[model samples]
Target: MDAYKLMTIAAIGFFVFALDKNQKKFPAPIILIAAGMFLAVFPYFSSMELTKEFIFHWILPALLFTSAYQFPQDQLKRKAAIIVTLGTVCIAITAVMLGFALYAAGQLLVGVSLAGAMLISSLLIPTDPVTVVSILTQGNDKHHLAETIEGESLLNDGTSVVIFSLFSGYYFGSQSLHIGTFILDFFYTALGGAIVGLLISWFVAKGIHKITFHVYQVWLTILLAYGSFYIGEALGVSGVIATVVSGLLLAKELTNKEEEEEKELRRDLKNFWGIMEPFLLSIVFVFIGIESIDFIQMDGLLFVIIGFLLSVIVRGIVLLATIKSVKPWRKSYTNGDITLVTWGGIKGTMSLALLLSITGQSGGSDDGLLSWAFMMIMLSLIVQSLTFYPLKEKLGD
Candidate 1:
């Protein structure tokens, strides 16, 4: 909220935009994060902090809505089973497996509690598809693999958050874990959120149809995006799911409508969101970079390395299972597709937001967990994202 901080971020955004215009191959996010790191170490900006409210309440809703709105509905229908499997079942599998693994590691090496280990595992479970989607869709070639990744990422954030709440509640002794209760809670939140999103989008689409002014239509679209999220949250459901469903529903309705005004409204909405997406993404990556300094101070390099490897292994196993169990009607996927999905399970803003949410409950021993989470995020963004392009070229044949 500081003026100087705002100016610095604006400057970084402009620099990234310029690079994007001229240096076609250079990844803008990488540069933004690197710039954030530079600023984080510099005395003037070193103290700048990324708050949970700013990220979750302000930036994330827009990003999530835009990503979901842009997702191809036809492709999503084809890959829905795979996306749901990875988003829900796979997340639960990874959380439990990784939780026990981290518990063992913590017990023998790091002195972290089992409950704490589970909480950390829950935090790391959600994958951020932003970097992976960008890398995969950089060219004209549209593949099912990209759609699957994007769909899973869109849906999994809400699931992971619900799971995290369960783990956090148990860890903090606020609630006991009951399997029946967990299942009920999960379905209620996820399904309720979807319903809320659908209803809001339906109403918003109707309103937009009546609007005579293009500007008002555009603003209405934006309102639907954020409104679905906030309304869902207020009603005690998953806001992420609400926002995603709303965006997708709105997009589908607009696409199916044949009216000229509806078509014009769709075009304007797409242009508006397209412009906002990069600006918001740049800010996120830069904040990630600047916040890396805290991650460094937390310092659990050995644990983080082990945890990252464990995450990769778990994701690979899940992908293999998905490949084997895919129904006959679904499109057959190659080993390359499985490998890409496994490695492409990147963690970003959602994980950070979850981590920050529990900072108050960590009892001053969460630094190592934070470090591990941070390292995993960085590895996903840098190493996995950069390598996937070449890997795709070699294996995607």
Candidate 2:
């Protein structure tokens, strides 16, 4: 048995659940990350590693599924236009600009293609909802701002997955990739995943109608969540998107029902996930803390710093350009809200997990890039997270 898993559970039991039950004063992510970092000093943890296969295949699907299912559909529908634009279009723009910037810099990137560099940086683009939302709830979160944040993260993370998958295929796969091929692939991957997810969700919904037992319902949904992802992957599409789409639609279906039994089932589903999400999240963040140290060092510090700056700066600029120029966003959102949204784009577990999974595929050769991504993520968490509350206070709802 791996002691890392045991250690993570202990840390969650003691630090997360016991001490920070409210998580108002000290958030779980920060606490778990600190625990992981503290534990990393031991000799045994120095060589600890989590494979990309485990992360992508096992952990990724569950985390993606839970977040998607729990996300409120009303908020997504209301903010559909802005959220979709920010999540997809802005993300694509930021990725391209950042990729070009890195390519132009010509430092820290060694023989890596534009797609490869974009793949590394795109992971940083999707802000962590759990980290931001937890902090927001501690303050005056209004205008469904917290939901907006969560929705943005959920949508953008899905977009990030598409971007990562597309780039990964083009950069690594044996094919003569060109602009036309890339554009076509970008659509195919995303649309393909959506179709797969919806079909599975429709079938699952039909099954859910006939099921009476709560336990059986939960079991079936579990299958749907993990199953959608596996099926999408097997079908040569995007599993990440599939899991998200299925979970989102199915969750909405459960929540939208007016019947008492449906409501009770929703409660049961919520209770199950209420326990499961945190357990999984704690392990991921703690593991990030332990594994991140190996990726950070003295030489790549400049590149990491630059990468972090570019990520933050580019995101802010893109948001400003996108929101201010657009008529609907300009009227709906104030400059202050934009500021909050921009600054609140705090990177957490999602970024690190995606990066780890990406780095895991390359083995030992891209340690420099891996270290750069890790360091940049640390900067986002430390600099952005610690300042998030005070920033929120200053920019009142």
The model with the greatest lDDT is 1
The count of backbone overlaps in candidate 2 is 0
TM-score of 1: 0.93
Model 1 is weakest, by summed lDDT over 10 consecutive residues, at 18-27
| Per-prediction backbone clash count | 0, 0
| Alpha carbon lDDT at 42, candidate 2 | 86
Residues 193-304, candidate 1, lDDT per residue (tens digit)? Answer: 9999999999998888788999998898889888998999999999999999999898888888888877788788889998888778778888888988878644566777
lDDT of 2 by residue, 131-210 (tens): 66776666554446677677777778767776665666665675554667656776787789889999999999989989
Task: Candidate 1: list runs displaced more than 4 Å.
Answer: 21-26, 139-142, 329-331
TM-score of each: 0.93, 0.90
